[model samples]
Target: MSIQDTVDEMAPLRPENRHGTDPLMVLNGIRQEFPSSRGRTVHALDGVTLTVERGETLGIVGESGCGKSTLARAALLLRRPTSGEVFFDGKDALSMRGGALRSHRKRAQMVFQDPNDSLDPRYRVQRSVAEPLRAAGVSRADAAERAMAALAQVGVPEDAAWRHPHEFSGGQRQRIAIARAIATEPELVVLDEPTSALDVSIQAQILNLLLELQERQQLTYMFISHNLAVIRHLSHRVAVMYLGRIVEVGPAADVLANPLHPYTTALISAVPEPEATKRERIVLTGDLPSPASRPTGCAFASRCWLATEQCRTEAPPLTTTAMSEPGSGHLVACHRPAEAQEALASGLQLTA
Candidate 1:
């Protein structure tokens, strides 16, 4: 099926239907904490809740330390969360052990940021691609056959399969990594900054390859990246994170075009525009708060241009606003969402 076909098939599942229908993945109130050297706990993730429907792409965007990667790892159960529930295809993923966990691992896969780091230089490309199949108990001969087929599918030459990862360029190695990811025919793929390391031209090629693979396999993607443009290009929905919390989430177009949270607005504004168009930029001040010493109220209040007394004292819950369409699920956590929305609508330049 084509991407559009998969989208159309799953179109009936609106954000409102997320809880009602069976989703590919569900993370409810996930929180990850680590003990800092200073004897305090760092909140890597704070109350992150999200759902990924089958055959849809959910793009996660945030600054470097905003817990996007932590959320991804928690979803995949790589790093168990300090608290929360993880449901994969309606099953309790966190509670599974041994055989059940192994079975679940086959259904979900991850493609890391750097292909060079992910692929073993000591092994042949084919061996690396077939590792998952071999781990699943497939015979060596069958795994080799599947590996070559997968390599060919990703535009890697069949003859090059026996070569080491160092033999190929960065983009080619990424193709090999992608081939390995889909070789198992996983239903969900968590891509953690998969294309960020490549040049712009190669990034486009990899993105196209990913979209094509998703279409052919009907795969669901949890794509994590700092690039808003890329997230807008490939995501059906977008989640914006700040300081271990999701500040805003909604349909990709709606969230990017009409951001409702101060953080989201600032993030979107930072996206490079055409040279001819003059757009107001929201330049935020103050460094990101240390996770171990996070503010008691809104994590972003210290740097938010629209912050009020309420923002400084009271934590805002992720609330669905009237600005959101009934099924669009546009939610924002802010004490002054209206002011933020108004600032964007009025094209006011904000420096805080």
Candidate 2:
């Protein structure tokens, strides 16, 4: 049977579904904290609120250790947030217990950066692919049949299904990992830099597969990556994170093409696009603020050339800038949104 035959149709949209809410997932006031050596708490995620509409890819971009993976796990309730709420399909996921939580988890899956971490070295590719479906209570025989179909969907040959992960190439291993994720028929797949470890040519193949699978399965994705070019290619919307806070977010075209925040510009300017030589002007200096001492005002203030007294003394709420399109929801947390683009062109130089 084709992979299509193994998977059932999706359920009808839930009624009262946040009642007119288009968001399939809603995260509000999400905060995650971990204790450090000196009994100081590291705020990995601080007050992040965002929505992922059904069947859209929301690309999350940021530097390493900016809580991209933490946010991905938190959204799935893998690590309960220190303070906040997560709603999946209008149902509060935080309070779920036993079967309900398992059901929620089944609908949301994650694709990690390394297939070596996600796939067991000892398990046969077929067995690994069938594991989640079996856990979801599928009969062993049926799970085996579906697993083969899933593997085929991702271009794994039927005869190779019995081989261990060690037998596959890096790209093939990732394809199997993707097969395992989609095998359960999840609604949302949180991909944490899934292609970062692959060769550039392999990256394109994996990206193309993800796009095809999303179109076929109507999957919602929270794709986390440091590659802005990849984000621009796969995302309908983009959220730029810094020091555990979203500095800017909006429609992908608007945020990438006309970013209002200095931090967002810095990320875009480093994309290594063909035009990067001429356009790569916004070089941000300084590492992200130390975890033990986060900034009281704007997280980017220490490095921002535009940092004014207001920016240094007070945190700017992420609100719509003057240039933001109405109903488009483009927002930035900058005290001087209007001057960012022009300033960059007119000798606003920042040291790397």
TM-scores for all predictions:
0.93, 0.91
| Residues 34-121, model 2: lDDT tens digits | 9888789999999999998888888899999888899998998878999999999999999999988877777998889999888999
lDDT per residue as tens, model 1, 1-352: 2223433443433454333245789899999999999689999999999988788888999998999999999999999999999999989999999989887887899999999999999999999999998887779999999999889889998889999999999999999999998888799999999999999999999999999998888889999999998997788788999999999987776677777898988887777765637766888887789888899889999999888888888999997887765667778998777788777666657766
**Maximum-TM-score candidate:** 1
Number of clashes in every candidate structure? 0, 1
Question: The CA-based lDDT of model 1 is what?
Answer: 0.86
For candidate 1, the C-alpha RMSD (Å) to the true structure equals 4.4
Lowest lDDT 10-residue stretch of candidate 2: 3-12
Give me the runs in candidate 2 sitting further than 4 Å from their true place: 1-21, 275-280, 344-352
Q: After superposition, how far is residue 213 of candidate 1 from its true place, in Å?
A: 0.7
Give the alpha-carbon lDDT of every model. Answer: 0.86, 0.84
* Residue 70, candidate 1: C-alpha displacement in angstroms: 0.8
Q: In model 2, what lDDT does residue 325 have?
A: 58
lDDT of 2 at 187: 96
